[model samples]
Target: MEIAQNYLDSIRFEFERYKTMGDATFAQLDDSDILWRYNDLDNSISQIVKHLSGNMLSRWTNFLTEDGEKPWRHRDTEFEDPFTTKAAMIAAWEKGWQCLFEALSLVNPDNFDTVIKIRNEDHTLVAAFNRQLAHYAGHVGQIVLMGKMIKGEKWVSLSIPKGQSEAFNTKKFNK
Candidate 1:
């Protein structure tokens, strides 16, 4: 039981970390930057946020009682950018994370092993948490990378800056 509680606590922390990364990336980007893609085949940050939001709403709503892939979810349509403004896109991102956190809050040791379904496939609660964590982390990484590319030399480092890892380690070790 303690293990289950600890796992939930850690998962929440991880999810918040990724969300903070995404938020920092967005802060560095302009409105147009969010819509930029390498090409027609690539997804813009806005589209990615839309997709993530849609997935979260579907998967987390009634998570213990319903399929993660909700019937109303139009997966392909998520790729289309419905948000005309950066604020709208960010709002959707917040909504998605809110749904995820709210659902996670309902989970306890008693239901830690509950079987959840994604697209009619069963997933243990921890498995579902891991799956979403990986997915969100990958997308957040993409957002940060693209923000860096768009900002170029102006990009502020979210972590230890390039070639400064040794300096960071020195500072940490000395503390």
Candidate 2:
């Protein structure tokens, strides 16, 4: 039981960390920046966020009970930008995260072994969490990369700054 709880706690912490990274990147972006794309082949931050939120909502809504890929979800449409304002986009993002967290709250050690379904495929709860965590992290990486590109030299470092790793390590070791 302790082990199961610990695992869930670790997963939650990782999800929160990734979400924070995305939030920080969003803060550095302007409304226009969120919609900027390199080319027709590329996706803008808004589209990525839309797709992420859509996936979150689908996968986490009735997480333990229903298929992660909901029948009502139109995945292709997620790539089409629907938000005209940054606030709206962020709201949707928050909604999706909220759904995920709420679903996660329902999971306890007793049910840790419950099977989850995604597109008719069976997944243990841990496997499902791992899968989504990887997916979300990948998208957040894209967001952070786009934010850096859009901000150029003005981009704030989310981790140790480019040449400051030495200083960061020094401070860490001295503590």
Candidate 3:
């Protein structure tokens, strides 16, 4: 079966939007803020980035040929403070996303029905892709929310700002 180009394009666009959200959120924070944990029970933004990066690389690389939970992936380590600087965290984030995009580019409509495994559970390619997309979006939302809380009023709105819906709609309607 031929995969529609529009479907693949939509997925790619959504993934890129999530990446932009993470980048914008990171931009609003200082290095210390990125590394600051609320308490012993919570993860810092840096830790979240590390975990996201690790997950992207593990799940996307060789996605169809091997299990998503790679044997070499130290998942627990992702929660630890492996990065001391915001720059390091950003680099890891970029690296992981790069791997994910590369893997996604290799997928086509023909493979949409192919079986893939995530931790030994089998799913069709389409199902697996949707599952991971949801997972990444969830994490990206967390990163953005945490950044917003940390930045408070100084935080730049990633989308339409509060109380501006009317103005935004007006502009859209005018267009």
Candidate 4:
């Protein structure tokens, strides 16, 4: 039981950290940057956020009682950029994280072993959480990379600023 609590706490921290990275990346980008794509084959940052939110809403709502793939989810359309403003997309992003965090809070040790389904496939609650963590983290990485590309020399580092790693580690070990 204690282990379950520890794991849940750790997962929440990791998710929040990634969310901060994405937010920081978003702060540096303009409207055009969010919708920019390298080519027709690539998705822009806005499209990635849309896809993430769609997945979050689908997987987290009625998470324990229903299939993760909600019947009403328009998965194909998530690849399209719907918002021209960053604020609108930020709201959507917050809503998605809210759903995920709320659902995660509901899963305690007593329910941690409960089986859930994504597209009719079985997964334990922790397994589902882990799967989403990996998926979301990958998308967040794309968001960061895209922001850096768009901002060019103006981009701020979200973690361990360039050429300072040795100092960072020295401070850490000294503490």
Error of 3 at 18 (Å): 0.8
TM-score of 4: 0.96
lDDT of 2 by residue, 18-102 (tens): 9999999999988899998889899999999999999999999988889999999999999885676899999999999999999
Residues 69-163, model 1: lDDT tens digits: 99999999999855768899999999999999999999999989899899999999999999999999999899898889889999999999989
Local error of candidate 4 at residue 133 (angstroms): 0.5
Supply the TM-score for candidate 1: 0.97
lDDT of 4 by residue, 1-175 (tens): 9999999999999999999999998889888888988789999899999999999999999999999999999999999756777888888899999999999899898988899999999998888999999999999999999898888899888889889999999999999
How would you encode candidate 3's per-residue C-alpha lDDT over 1-175 as one tens digit per residue? Answer: 3355667788899999999999999888878888777788989888988999999999988997999989999999999865888899999999999998998888887666678889999987677778989999999998898888898899899999999999999999999
**Model 1 CA deviation exceeding 4 Å by range:** none
User: lDDT of each structure?
Assistant: 0.94, 0.94, 0.88, 0.92
True-vs-predicted CA distance for residue 93, candidate 4, Å: 0.4
Lowest summed lDDT across 10 adjacent residues in model 3 is found at: 1-10
RMSD for all candidates, in order, please.
Answer: 1.0, 0.9, 1.4, 1.1
In terms of lDDT, which candidate is strongest? 2
TM-score of each: 0.97, 0.97, 0.94, 0.96
